[model samples]
Target: MAGTLQFDLVSPERRLASVVASEVQIPGADGDLTAMEGHAPTITTLRPGVLKVVSTEGAKSYVVTGGFAEISATSVSVLAERAVPVEELNATLMDQLIADASEATAVAVDKDAADKAMADLVAMRAAAGF
Candidate 1:
């Protein structure tokens, strides 16, 4: 595992994934970034998008609503606000998510909240290939 890093994706409910991975794609608040073994240590806030994990076992993708990631030379830990495995995603679920986001956006009390909700909707749509 010299070229691999421990990656863990945790949500409020439970841990979603814990494995050794070659690379992980994260949706940083500023942008997307990829983490690999020997990467510089850093912390980043996450945006709503897909988190892709690549390892010897193959690739797996997860849809994250928002979160934070702590990256280190040998580990990447993701604390997600909400996450769902891509395998469980479907057009119907995507539509529901979009609709729920739209409602949240409409009810947002402030411009920042509204913007965030809108962005989440956009990201969810993109991830769902809508």
Candidate 2:
């Protein structure tokens, strides 16, 4: 059996998850990465995409608009700007998020990054069937 690491996902709204997970798939700003037990110590910025986790209970997913992830050999902690369980994502909510992203993009300092994030959100919405 694979080793498990303590994984926690939090947002300004609430703590969405705390579990012993075998793997965590992060939507990193630079790229996507999967963290497992005994992984390297590092931190990564998140982008708008689906975050996946596999644990003893089952596989779960979350939608994170942006955030920072702190990874260590024994743990992975995600502090999200906005986070929602994938199951809870609906068309109304997705539309709101897209509108928000569009506004953010207009005023963003880094236009390229904002554009990328907006693209990611669109892709996520499509994947969610919205």
Candidate 3:
């Protein structure tokens, strides 16, 4: 078996996950990356996408709007602006998320990031069909 690392994900609402995982797939602002045991220490901003955690127990996924990930050799910590388990996402929930993003985009001073985030949320909704 591959080496494991501690992984934790949290948002303002609650703590979503705390587990030991073989790997974690992150949706980085620049691109996608994977973190694993013995990985180099780094931090990156997260984009809107599914965050997948593969562990001894099984695979779990969460939808994150925006966030920061701190990856160290021993652990990966994610602090998200908003997050929801993939299983809990539905059309109603997705609609609200998109609407919220839209509102935020309209008022944002920096259009680049808001535009990118809005685009990603749309893509995520399309990909998930919700």
Candidate 4:
């Protein structure tokens, strides 16, 4: 098998990452999917969770809110709703965000709106590991 695959991670704001990695684990719709060089071409929807990339240097993790991943034989591209490096995550900020989302959801008159807010808050908390 080949040693590495080219990887790109993009968000609505900008391209968050571009690198070559030996392996990557993504939060797929069904579950976590691991990819490596020479993998078959496919596309998968991603959930809000941690994406782990492994290289000769080491493993790095990123928090992805939502997106789709395109996997080719030699490349993988992820277009995310929101993408952030794990190193940049702040527990305090996440806590505040969760509280705000919760408060808004609690007073929301529309059930669907409240559900979406709750889901968003849960996803953010999950991605942040809080």
Clashes per candidate, residues 3 or more apart or on different chains: 0, 0, 0, 0
RMSD of each: 3.1, 1.2, 1.7, 5.1
Per-residue C-alpha lDDT of model 3 across residues 51-127, encoded as one tens digit per residue: 99999889999989878999999899999989999999999999888888898789877788788888888998998
**Candidate 1: worst 10 consecutive residues by lDDT?**
104-113
Positional deviation of residue 125's Cα in model 3 after best superposition, in angstroms = 1.3
Cα lDDT for residue 41, model 4?
96
Give all candidates' CA lDDT scores: 0.84, 0.92, 0.91, 0.77
lDDT of 1: 0.84
Worst 10 residues of 4 by lDDT: 96-105
> TM per model?
0.79, 0.93, 0.89, 0.72
List runs of model 3 lying over 4 Å from the truth. 107-113
Candidate number of the best TM-score: 2
lDDT of 1 by residue, 68-125 (tens): 9999999999999888898888888777766665675676566675576567667667
Comparing 2 and 3 on lDDT, the stronger one: 2
Per-residue lDDT tens digits of candidate 2, residues 19-38?
99999999998889999999
- Pairs clashing within candidate 3: none
Measured by lDDT, the strongest candidate is 2
